[model samples]
Target: MRSLLSRRFRATRAVTAATAVLALASVTGQVAHADTPAVPEFDDGFGLSQVTEDREVHSSTDFSITVTTPEVAGQHKIRIFLPSDYASEPGKRWPVTYFLHGGPGNPDEAGTVEALRSDQMITVAPDGGRKGWYADWLMQDTAEGAANWETFHLEQVVPLIDANLRTIPDRGQRAVVGLSMGGFGSMHYAQTRPDLFGHVASMSGGIDFGNYAVRGAVVATELNLTTAWCAVSSSRGCADYGPVVDSDAIFGSPYPVFNADHIWRSVNPAASANLAKLADTGITLYTGDNDLVENHTADGVDIVTSRLDKLGIPSRAVNYGDGSSLSPTCNGGHNYGCWAPAFADYIPRLEAAFAAEETK
Candidate 1:
């Protein structure tokens, strides 16, 4: 039964073909928290094996880029797969999808490779920032913490990939997906830069950062801001732990607005006015039944769905019966172990969407 399900998860040719086309055309491209190990190192020639004739896998230890953000310096390594037809048919363009790793600290090389093997699509994962929420600073002084992340991604990373790799060059061919912090990043990127990605997906994402902060799931010290605004606006002096601020002065009036705005902009699909843009671009949302962060996931889905409905934008959401958030399998939890399968299941749908767009 498990094997059968796995087979079902594999990418179909229709999807593979579309992905290949988008990837080829996208010359455009495009994180951290830590104390955790730096992104993992892989063998230079590592690649995925095709589960089917239509799929092919490729991995490169050299598939990496480094960005020196104003606040932090980091390296991003990526693993990619090109469909069997990609090399054979040199003239084609393929759509691209980025997979984001959870934990902000975890590296996504292996699972990314696995998903590529089954899907025969272009995929990449970059390490998230050192334990930060990938936000823009609320205040200029706190730019290092979260604000720089946006610059690192939009300026440093995307341009590097487009210059270095054989990929689709336009935003219409690109998509983003991730788990936990990565999931939040995926949605946040799509909202912030609708012109850069065609679709976005979040799996058990930490989508409600405002709620999390309010609940104290996020430590005050980890936040670097005089108020959160300062953190959002500037990378310097952003860590609450690094420097003491007069909270009495900074916390009350405008800081909360920045916090609310940040959250509202990041996951509140309605706030970005991008739902119509997503409908035009083919965005998708998904989560598991047993995602560890059930409340956030549910809220994300509900909010996006409600917004999309009001805007009359067509979208799809999936909830696997498996409740475990760590494993991708039926018993896996919210981590990669659980998301890999969800990714596998979604690849075909993604491909089909791409294919449909191409024909039109």
Candidate 2:
């Protein structure tokens, strides 16, 4: 259901050469990718049923894999940056890190990939698709290139990696981190499936999708922008994993009348069953002092930390304030300037978590 806002948004966007390339790209948007399948296909639940693309990079193995899966409108993609000695050390099994990118992910996320690849673990980046919301659609689009992102990542992608790669393949052996939309995805996925990830971090993620300072600000505005793209700058350009859809397609209608179920609330970190699982997991929250979304991004971090106060589950809360040596954001808007440092701040923590699991 492309609305007037969508049409207007598409018409007014600044699609740069790199961004035009992004529109039909992978989850990271760093490499060239395959077109989404016309009809959806299911995986066997064991591993990748079919692989359409695979290529290599330098000392570390950087490859993008396109696989057939019923969860998405087209083939889901996986971008892997393997350890430098991944080829030489066949016998050694390594821990894995899952990186979730933002709505339109940082264009040059190569640093993060390189860091993970060289850091002593394998890096796994899965395609979240355009405006996928990192959640399965509440109502199916039933159109070409529709997406079932939740099933695609948790059901299809996770097993696909473990089955094929030499991963420790356990809860403590794996970590998940994301930027912005991915921040939401990382936390949501970590909470929803407590068995899968040992460590979770969100970089400038508007995590309080349910109610931060004001209710529904995340899904209604930020998440909504990803769907219709009403306010994206040409510099940012769209990053494509699949077709862009409206917020309704992912959660529910943007307007309040349609969200009586509080789908957003259900997914919030403060909700049910959270008392136990999250207490066992290491959680990190990051947000720049000045975010483009009126700094509400910080509100979610505050809310989650405050709510979890009794449990003492959250390990770290890093707010790169207006005057900090680490990711100093002197009141500037949301940009990559902060993410790189935030990512750097989290890498060691991820390594520490992975190391802890190795001992047990």
Candidate 3:
């Protein structure tokens, strides 16, 4: 497998350029149809048939749900894969893994499909609201843009998936994983609400918002004029959408600071003291050494892991072998390619986490 770093760098460069163009056009009042599919829909063994209770279970049919939250409204097209024995053992609850997507996009990539199959766990990939940070942002036009993804995941998606599918609703049986932005979201959500998830993983995730703010600003500048960048300040009319308070607090500040600390403290998990709370739960952190893009950095993971260590929190961090930067492939990088295989490797560990929760 190509190292996570190489994949992240390549993917980030591609996404950055693409996002810049989109943001510039949007800011210029160039409204485009939002109905276009963000990613191509394809099956990677997720739709295969299975046998249960001596009966064949067809995988052609999967659930597609639309979860509308106050902050943001979007669809969660899910592919529910029951274990081979699920049909035979009716009413048995199984662990669920909420897989997330990178950037402001869909999780229908090839690698993601493969991960769903290899994990054989009930996988849920909801569209992570507008801007794709999976968090509320400062831009008002994108006000509804900042989907309360955290709330949606815990309150809406989890319960709905559990109720509608054959999933173990207990917190212990639940987990989340993602790559790039999705990776950041997984760890952020897990750290913020440890009571809800047992195991969390990120593959070449962009976990540090402090770093992202600078990169995002740079990308915004490159994509559009300075006026477009300035417009982001007013959420109501701004075309460039992103977190509002980052640049003011981190990069420049002349007068005595008020609330700047709190603003900075809130978004960066590395700055939060509550991160230790996740230790009582469990965390699986992984990134590639060469991932030196906007958010995918060894330094980012190192920052979080170091904090966890300080709090005596038990966690696992892995760095894949060395390789040049590559886009997420079917087999490697932060995209579905690498995520699918990694998911397979983590299945037993996730099952054990669920089992441990059961005993408790």
Q: How well does each candidate superpose onto the true structure, as a TM-score?
A: 0.63, 0.75, 0.65
Residues 1-360, candidate 3: write the lDDT tens digits. 235686575456445544553332433355323232122122112112112112211242233433334545433444345555654565676788887765434544422355365334566676663244655443334324434556666666666666546777666788888766677778778877787787888766666655655345433432333443232211133344334433332222222267544543565656547576686666886665632242345667788788888888877876653422232442222334445555666667777777778878
lDDT of 2 at 17: 27
Quick one: best lDDT, which candidate?
Answer: 2
Best-to-worst order by lDDT is 2, 3, 1
In model 2, which regions exceed 4 Å deviation?
A: 1-47, 51-60, 106-113, 142-145, 212-247, 253-259, 272-276, 328-332
Worst 10 residues of 1 by lDDT: 43-52
Clashing pairs in 2: 37-74, 41-69, 41-70
- Candidate 1: segments with Cα more than 4 A from true spot: 1-62, 65-72, 84-90, 109-113, 118-120, 139-147, 209-277, 289-292, 321-328
lDDT values of the candidates?
A: 0.50, 0.63, 0.54
Clash numbers, per candidate: 68, 3, 15
Candidate 2 C-alpha lDDT tens digits along 114-220: 45554488888877754566887786754435467888888878877786678898989888888767788888899888899878988767577555343343344
Q: After superposition, how far is residue 70 of candidate 1 from its true place, in Å?
A: 5.0
Q: Report the lDDT tens digits of candidate 1 across residue range 47-146.
A: 1111112111223221333333443333344455445565456576567777665532434343443655433356666555544445444443443333
